[model samples]
Target: MRRFFLFAGLLALLSGVVNAQDEFVTDSVLLHEVATYAPYKKYQAGAKMESIPASQVEIAQSAGLDQLLSRFAPIYLKSNAGGLSSIRIRGTAADHTSVNFGGININSLTLGQTDFSSVPVYLFDSFDLQYGSSSAVNGSGSIGGAAYLGLNGNWTDGARVKATASEGSFGEQLYGAKVFLGNGKFESVTRLYYFMLKNDFPFTRTSDGKEFDQENAMIENMGLIQELNYRFSSKEWWKTAVWIEHDWHQVQALMSSHPNVPSETLDNKHIRIWSEYENRRHALQYKGGLGFVHDMQVYDNNGEQKIGTDRLIAEIEAKQDVHSSFGYKIGAKYKYIKPDVYAYSSDVIDHEQSAAFYLSSFYTPLKTLKLTVNLRQELVTNFDVPFTPSLGAEYRLLITDLSVLKLTGNLAKSYRIPTFNDRFWPELGNPDLKPEKGMSYELGLQYQYCSAAIQTDVKLNGFYMDVEDWIEWRPGSIGWEPENRSRVISQGVELQSNTDVFLRKMSFNFRLNYSFNPTEIKEDQITSLVGKQLIYVPKHVATVYLIAKHGLWSAFADASFTGERLADHSGSAKFPNGTVLDSYFLMNCGLSRDLKIKEQDFKLSLAVNNLLDNDYQNQPDYAMWGRSFRFTLSTDLNFNKNK
Candidate 1:
């Protein structure tokens, strides 16, 4: 009780650190930046894409990307005690979803996936999720979905700085700082963050109902993003950004272990550099970019295993207006990858060079109807990848001042190339593997209504996808070797709603999302596995979130539910007839208050996760952290405003 009063007193005292000023400004100027060669434009449309609200992202600023997405997105995240988290979209495998950095696919060349735990939610200015298969725009490896991440330039002709400090249960500490500076022509965005967790939380054993503190689960992560934007004229500009991060973690033993013995550690480092130039005009608009990604990781089980990859990419694209109702884009891209690993056939430098061409056209004969056609072709050395083509159309059903309804549909073909580990892992690797090809169909209906009293949006979507020559690892004569084995089928339905209600002095926003996904193997050598749902894939997921805002107070709550998942066959009592994991529901909530500390803006927030503190496990033997509380304080100062 005394500590609470002292904390309140300190907050009150800090609220008067500066003199009052009337020129407190809050807004940034959105600057034009060159595009990074994409075949399908978002506005012209191909898939169901949604952007995360900036206001809602504030609560997860210090948390990882998995935490943020788990609160809103309907996809399942196989989070291993908050340690190795990966995304599985609509029952698709983690590797099937492409994680792109500024329009460039940056999934590991060795593992063919990205660790969601390695990404900080505060690094990017904008985050978007694209539903269904989008290989026509996102390139290879997007068999299920894609996430586009980038930083936007907000040159507001002023200097602003914000510092954040947070502390949570179980020895959680977070510190971050952000700076934004603009001089009309030159703009800079700098972000730095450091977070650590001594994950020594208590957990109960599922076997005998005993308890023990989790051990060997410490994590320390830090990152930096430095972006600079320069404008040459009203229609031309350049952008350069550098991102660096390091994550060091100690692997935790399973909760079922009494004297836990897993003492492995993971060390990961990432460095990314990108630069782009865009010339925008009436009809002839073109963009060009050069980027590089450097990733290295070391894992220790009994001995240290090291792997690293370096990738360089170059792309250019131009768009023009052919007629009043027709437009088209042409682009070409090239990527080179080099990998260093100890499990390879040889230590010799092995480099892969690939080139691709992208073309798309947009036509709108009437104001209420529009169509787009996209095609992409790629060439690799000594291998063949199927050419991809897609078509999308949108038609407005009703348009008025109070409401609008639209119908959307898309058909696309996609493919995924074999990863380096699948093709080069000593004798077990299969150099004769083939690319996985897939075809997908989508249909959606969207309705929106807006007025002074309320605003609402509802969307219903369905997708069916089939993949051929799916790669699988099997026991061969030499060992486990990769092979093009099974044909899989995935289908799902999604329902979403976004609503805003305005009262006299208060406003409320509600968001709901739900999906029913079923993925099964169609053809496989193992007959029993055929027609069975993929292990670790869930069939149902949903999330509901609410945000409320008043004069100086705001609050948010998120509730998420995941249905039963198919567990791997163990032939035990627990899995006598292919039994599975049980469903789980989780909730997170936060409350925040905004304050004016003289000339600066201040915010204080309190967040709680797993409010119910349910004793549950995502899978067998892996226990959750139960519940945790976090308190954060942020201060921002702006200078040279009204420029």
Candidate 2:
């Protein structure tokens, strides 16, 4: 406790020294920077798209990407004791959700899933979540949704630099810095971040009722990002970026029963470089990129395994505006993927190549009505992918100075190809597996109200999806093999609301989001598993956050609730009538004070997560963390020689 008190006292002293020039500043520096971007424009006419601003992203920088999503977004994160985390969107499998960074797909070609826990939140300036099927625009493997992380190259007025340092529970430390430099014709932004953690939290085993401390759990991560932009002419510009990340972590045992297992480790490295050129005068754009990823796992019991993947992508697009009421986009892309795995005393290599052509048309015949149509066709090397298409429409029902209401609907077809592991993994692979196909439908209503003192927004959406040829691994006469044996159906409802009120000297913001999703296996080859809920899928999830700010001090509280979910596919003798995980509720609170030291700005914040100390697990035998605390200090510096 001495350390806490010492830090608190130091902050108080600094606050007092900086408060002499008391000038009320309502907005944050991060928010001010985000405002420089062009106002967000909807890419999809009727899709459910949510963009998280830079200010909010900064609030959760120390917690990684998975924690940020679970606290604020409607998606679900399946965590293994804070080790590796995967995302599930709208009751879909982890592999069904596509992750993209700056127009490049970052999902692994071998495993087909991206680990959200390994990604740092500080690398990207913007986060966008697109709900429902987006295969028409994002290509295959987007059966549920798509997530996009982008870096904005729009520089500030002059040159600026920002730095942050944070410490948290379980011996976690983070340090990062960002630099921005620009004039009129040239601009550049560079970032460097490093984080380390020792995850040795204590937990109690549910089955045996015994207490134990986690062991052999540690993580070290480092990343760097560089972006540059050049404006050759008023209508022509070139942009390029490079990103590299490296991670090394020790793998812990699965359960308390195996605490004395041998040492295990996982290492990963990734590198990507991309460039794009756009000429608005000619209505043309061209982009291309190359990425490389290497992964290695060392285990005493299973020997060493290494996997490498390389991706090459190129695309050219054209846009035309025929009239004031209509516009269209046409694009063609080609992608080549090669994966090599070294396991089982041999080397396995495979190739996947595809070419896709897409066309999208938008029409605003009337001021109150808008329509969009999109179609895509892909030709794969060894698989026959069906034609995918989507249609969406939006109409304004009522409009006035105080309130507005809008209705939107969409229908789309999507598909996911089998991964390399599913097709050729020694004795466990099945080369006859077929791709999973899905059809989805959605309808939504949105209402917005604005006034001098208050602002409110509400949205409600309902969706349904049917999938065929769902892949599953089952025991065969010889051994376990992957097969296409199940037909799945999923339906859900989403509701969201946000309200902001401004008083004489204070402001309050409230946000609430809820999702009700139930996924089931409608038809299956196994009799015992038919008509059962899918594993690790929750029926209901909800989140709420309240913020209050007055002058330089601000406070906020967040609450999240997850409903009960099944643990396994079928019941067994050990787990009577099938294992089910109970529902859990978590609460978090934070307080921060902003100070102005001359021209620079400083902020100190203290946060407590899992306030109630809830004991729960998203995956069986993997206990979650207890109550934890985090402290962060950040500052921004501006340089202007003329000033």
Q: Candidate 2 has which clashing residue pairs, if any? A: none
Error at 236, model 2, angstroms: 2.7
Choose the strongest candidate by lDDT. 1
lDDT of 1 by residue, 459-559 (tens): 78999989999997777888888899899999989877777777999987777777889988999987778888887778888777778899999999887
* Candidate 1 clashing pairs, residues 3+ apart or interchain: none
Off by over 4 Å in 2: 1-43, 258-261, 282-304, 343-350, 573-577, 640-643
| TM-score, candidate number 1 | 0.92
Error of 2 at 367 (Å): 1.5
Cα RMSD (Å) per model?
A: 8.0, 7.5
Model 2: how far is 604 from its true place, Å? 0.5
